[model samples]
Target: MSVDSDIISTLTQRAKQRPRRIILPEHGDERVLQAVCRLASNGAVVPVLLDAPTTDTATIPDNVEIFSRRSDAAQWRDRAAAELFARRAAKGTTAEQARASLDNPLLLAALLVGLGYVDGGVAGSVATTADVLRAGLHGVGLADDAHQVSSFFLMALADGRLLSYGDCGVIPDPDAEALADIAIATAAGHQRLTGAEPRVALLSFSTRGSAQHSKVDKVREAFDIVRRRQPSLRVDGELQFDAAFDPIVAQKKAPNSAVAGAANVFIFPDLDAGNIAYKITQRIGGAKALGPLLQGFARPWMDLSRGCSADDIADVAVIASLLGD
Candidate 1:
């Protein structure tokens, strides 16, 4: 098997060993139902459907549990609404607004995760990315140590290596501090998901002092912050993409750097660079991009691409289950 397949197989096996209860809010989507069936069959997760399937019920496995807000007891809904209000009260969310927000499957799914009803949630098939992330932020909130929420794509290259690309889906223009947070969070996530210590590279247009620009300075400052915050981490930066990925370029440009040319986790300067880079890697470089999976959240919640397939949903569900671990 290919290394990407092997990695996914291992992750699925690990998730099956101790299956998590995961919510799929977009039950109306055929792909979500198919993924539910796959998860049930594989024993990778206990797939919880947020509402009754709009399609034929037999397509859903018997192991799947349905939680319909319409059919559920009023007392429980009230409790959930209260919890939502409490969580969002600081955002000027009125009790009525919190109660109404529960009508949204995305928000409800996140609330379920936060209330410990499920281990995690996967949505965004039909919902926009902003709605999905807003639900997670409002309902589940951030990890205690996390200053902000960031995202990473686990790129499984055809060459049999796994790397992480960060801030690709969130944070349009991160300042130095936010960039540092993205690096730290993505590094931890890389270790947790891939079982490899992160060798992080803060990518830039310049290699060290080869060029000068405000953007380069931002990357360098972020690199310094990462080093200060995570002194033991193997990290280097203001590196060009080639210097970060190719040993030959590293030898020429940044020979003494600990993480040069061997970076398993790459932190981009902005969302434009990160998003574009991961797509190019996936399309042209023939890498499997496993995420834009969210990091820095207290619980695991995934945002799927609108174009994601059933297999993609299943893969992400398994990944989310493991992340909750």
Candidate 2:
């Protein structure tokens, strides 16, 4: 399905009102360069290009600031190295290892973010998800309140509705507590990003007491934990996909559920289910999946799909900028 243009427009408008300085680190990729130009031209952000080739200056917009490791290395290297060493000192990372890591563009962009050189950053177009996330964790670190980092997709349906699917790209097998945290974080993120009230659904193979298994029990336990943690949040769980999505099915399967048939945030039981569900929704169901956005971090840093287009990178940069608000 095509993306909901209204969502992008709204986000773009919001970002333009307060253009953020966002770093794009994949300088070698044409797609990333294209996105940087778009962001600069639109005035939606101050796009910072890391290690961009000087030969490409004519193609690069004037508003885009080029960060060169060759000439600018002396200014940031020592400071970045010191910060990295401090953060990873417990892991036996030597000062030399920390200094050498600054050469990596992804880690350098993340360190710039940690050092407040930019509002946030977007990467992963030419990098693996593992590498992108590792840079974010080692450089930016997690929020004080966050126990673990998680990811979520901003799914824009063909019908012009936006939904959130969580832990699709991180945490392979979250237990009950972790699952609950994912739900809470995704719900909060949904509200923040979309300006819509969050109705969360903990997805399962069974709806209520229709069937029983350890997996079903885990969903149920997660539901309880979410309730205990955020009593004011509208949430229900142990619901089949149909029951959670279709009002007709919800009426028959879980009539009294607070979030049945109206959920905007969906928490999958594990990475396998979340990943498969999002791909199916994007491929067969014709929805546009805008993320795999990293959350629960101290600051905003995003992970783009390796196969993403220039438009996808531009849109994610806007989203990352807005998350900084």
Candidate 3:
């Protein structure tokens, strides 16, 4: 989800309209259950525990749906090899293909979603990054129109500012065009998660002609590409962190950038800055780090770190429900 208040409201509307029954991966832990419970009690979709052992049910909410993981391991899809090969391969599937797919945990989970055995897959607390992407990519697949499935983080400043920090958790160093695409996606995601019509600031050390180098030039070029891609969007770039977030600093530095100080969404030029900025804010600055939103998907799938609390699970569950089809 996004930090934009409007995006928050949008999720609220989704909770009211089409609540889902998300599928938890096999033997998924207690923390995850707690998260599911928080959202369900508050009118989000009911959680459907999948592949979880029977002994574990005692700790889960009584009303939540539970799918026997043991059964799904063999029953979700039969035409292929894995019982849960998603709806995408109901026909023309080979056992060898299914076997290879199941080798990937993400793919295995995605198969369940693909076959409609589950509404969505929420893993990551117990799997590797490779596992998460491989499954989601194979099972859910990308939107026919999208070229890639990148990631984003939903960050909220303690001072009541909310915005997205992106591709930090996914791509290491995106090219100018990839950066441009990420910006557009992040802005749209901001609207979806926070309901804010984004005024984006593409942040770098260099603000509008203040400096010129490969790094600065990248930000400048990406900004141009993003603007061309989405002319209706209000985005500008090559801005310093201060100029992007502090209006006074922006006026003094750039003098003419629409994004200076008026910005609500910031697009980082690279991973080093984006990842470092968010960590510092989350750790030292006392801000709430809501998400690595996992945007650019056809379905409402999200991930969790194994170290996360039950509260984290519940919040993300609500977010996934809010993004449902």
Candidate 4:
């Protein structure tokens, strides 16, 4: 079965109360706006385009709320200056410096959220990952259940089985314990996105001691830690991807394991394998990859790489809004 397209449409209809703020950072493009417009038309969010006034005005949608309205060279600029001065005096910022940080649109957006003008932010695509990550790490508090922020992708497979692969979007080269942390966060994300409790197999090249590798040893230890600490979860690993995914292969390779032969989540050994597998699956095999979806933050925040499409923005917005509610 396909994932519901109305995941966005329905969320849009029900999101009338306290709609989140989706801030478009500098050079955040048209395709991005098109996606925001879909959410706007459906009433799911307050879309505030961060900087639309300059030469790039033609790129934005005609009806979208833009920061352009605040700029007029003579009249509004002075008013902006005066307000900046007063606000600076009130907040102990120097007049010269009132405009310093705010000149950076990220600081502006952070001010908006901190002052409670909006619920959250969706950034990246046009902005750098460092830019978005800095804003989030410095802006939002950690969510109650999470100790540290992390990322995950809820892979909506073309075949009807769902899978999640992660920390690809964050936490590079995780240790055994950190991988266990990734597994737990990834499991929660799988449940949140697909309404499916994960049966996660920590994937690697070797299977059940048939071959030896340093990577395999790390995954094996991670599995034990995960099993002991999070007993409610169904997980096993150090299996190959095929074993993790194929019931027959899993049954034969890693016999009599509850997590084997019926796994829904596949945690990769490291960044290289996870990235390559998903990229190959998407570009070569044509799987529908929805996220390097950011999970475990206190507020719903997602990042868009420069390659993101209008639909990608829309999907992420839906997922972020779903998590917020």
Candidate 5:
């Protein structure tokens, strides 16, 4: 099936309400080009095309803004360079190297977002995850109190319901602390995207000690960490899938949890489970998976799958715009 139109419409409307400036680094990619056009045409965001005003400017749509290398030169020669140089210098980049790096679309786009010239950025259509991660960390930096960067997928159920499944793309394995961070971050994202209070569940194979394993202990510890750190947050843990999603099973397994059986956000114990679960929901259960969207960034920066389609890029752009709000 196709992506849920209702989900798209909701995000698109949210984006249009206060359209934010979004930088698209891979303007050379056909998918990026198509997606940017769609975003601009619908007024969801001001699509800023980095590296596009070069010789290939003729193909770009007028509604989109092209931020060429030449335009970035003014910034590179001024205050932006000083800040960018400071960020890169610790990694052994010299003043000259930092200046040159600013001309590259990825770094330049990140600089714009950092400098508050734009609200957020969307890239990775033609870049590696490493490249995107490096640029984002080096430039935009992490959100306050975030110990590590992680990711989540906004799963749109066949019934038009939305769920947040986290740490599926970035963290391969997390200790209690990182898992707590993922839970908190994903809960915030879940609330922001859906406008509903998040009911977060830290997932595991066991439900309230029904099964015994080190893995179950890890999830339980992470749940405790979340509860301690964010006491006001509605969260529960060590829940099996049925306990987390099925009310009858939840009553039997985790009767006291406010989050059980009504969880809109799920934090899986490891990447293996999170990744497998999201794919299973998408492929077998026929859900529309809209992310693997990075979280815990000071300014929003979405890293697309290299295999992403134009529609995927467009959807992510809208999601990025929503982050600005």
Candidate 6:
């Protein structure tokens, strides 16, 4: 079993109720175009393509809106530039620089979302992770309560259970405070997307007092911060993967913890661990990793795996449409 098919079906139905206008900056990419077709066909979103498909123009759907580079600038440049400057002026950005940056496809897509020309933006099939995240940070900005941008993968297990693995694709080496922030952001996102109460576990190489190291100490400290800051949040930490996910191991290891045998959200100690874990689950364990879905942004902007298929893009867009709700 993969992600509950019902969850995707439900989200697509919700998206159709109030279809979001989602801009695809890499419209020329075949995978992006295919995903756009899927989204348009389902009425899940109003697919806005930055540029017409170069090779598959004949396959483009009737409802898909394709904009040339010149046309996009002609239509939205003034508004996008003004919005960009307004958001960046405090950092001493000049109008000239703002206008120049708006010419960038990714930046313009994000700016369109920020300015409300569109509801969200999805790219990265043809862009690097850094490029995708930078556009979002500069254009959509960070959420008020969030310290910085972080990410989460919606891991759909073989047992048809959904879990969140966070800070997997961003924030290379977050400190304890940052880790706490990632956990909070991820937990909130998990609730919003899945409509399930999050039971968060901060994963480390040790379970409770089984090991002693600065890394273990960091996990403990972050766990404390999360609990103290959000007293109502159900969370635990210094848990190894086994203790976090397996009931038998949890009972033998960190017993009496609310999140111990049933963690729906896993916060990693670092990007290295988080990235490795998610990939291993997807490849070796046959889990469906729906994202590296971006979190902590004011407006919804998502990154795609460079290796993602068209189906992956469409699935991520459906989730992005539900973000910022």
Question: Which window of ten consecutive residues has the lowest lDDT sum in model 1?
Answer: 68-77
Residues 1-325, model 3: lDDT tens digits? 4344444455556665777767666344666766666666776667776544545566666677655434444555453245433443667666676676665546666666656666666777787667777677767766554567777777776676676787667777888887887888888777777777998888887877878789888888898898787899988888888988888998899788777888877788777878898888778976667677676666767777778777666667767665556
Candidate 3 RMSD to the real structure = 4.4
State candidate 4's TM-score: 0.76
Pick the lDDT winner: 1
Across 1-325, the per-residue lDDT of candidate 5 in tens digits comes to 3458878988999889899999898877888888887887899888887657445556677778766545564754465677788887888988888777777778878877887878999989899999998888877888887988899999999987899999899999999999999999999888888899999999998998989999899999999999999999999989998899999989999998888989999999999999999999999989988888899888899999899999889999889888774
Residue runs of model 1 more than 4 Å from their true location after superposition = 2-4, 69-76
**Model 4 over residues 1-325: C-alpha lDDT tens digits?**
3444534444455555556666555444677767766766766666667566455656555555665465543353334444555645766767677556567666555444433444566777778877776666545545666666667776655665567887666777888887888888788878766677789889888888878888789999999989988999999888888887788887789998778878888788788878887888767765667678776666666788878877777666666665664
Give the lowest summed-lDDT range of ten residues in model 3. 79-88
Encode model 1's per-residue lDDT on 164-273: one tens digit a residue: 99999989999999999999999988997888999999999899999999999999999899889899999999999999999998999999999888889999999999
lDDT of each: 0.90, 0.89, 0.71, 0.69, 0.87, 0.88
TM-score of each: 0.93, 0.92, 0.83, 0.76, 0.94, 0.90
Which stretches of candidate 4 lie above 4 Å from their native place?
Answer: 1-21, 26-28, 44-100, 110-117, 144-149
What are the clash counts of all predictions, listed in order? 0, 2, 17, 0, 0, 0
Clashing pairs in 4: none
Candidate 2's TM-score: 0.92
Which residue pairs clash in candidate 5? Answer: none
Which 10 consecutive positions of candidate 4 have the poorest summed lDDT? Answer: 72-81
Model 6 is weakest, by summed lDDT over 10 consecutive residues, at: 66-75
CA shift of 243, model 4, Å = 1.7
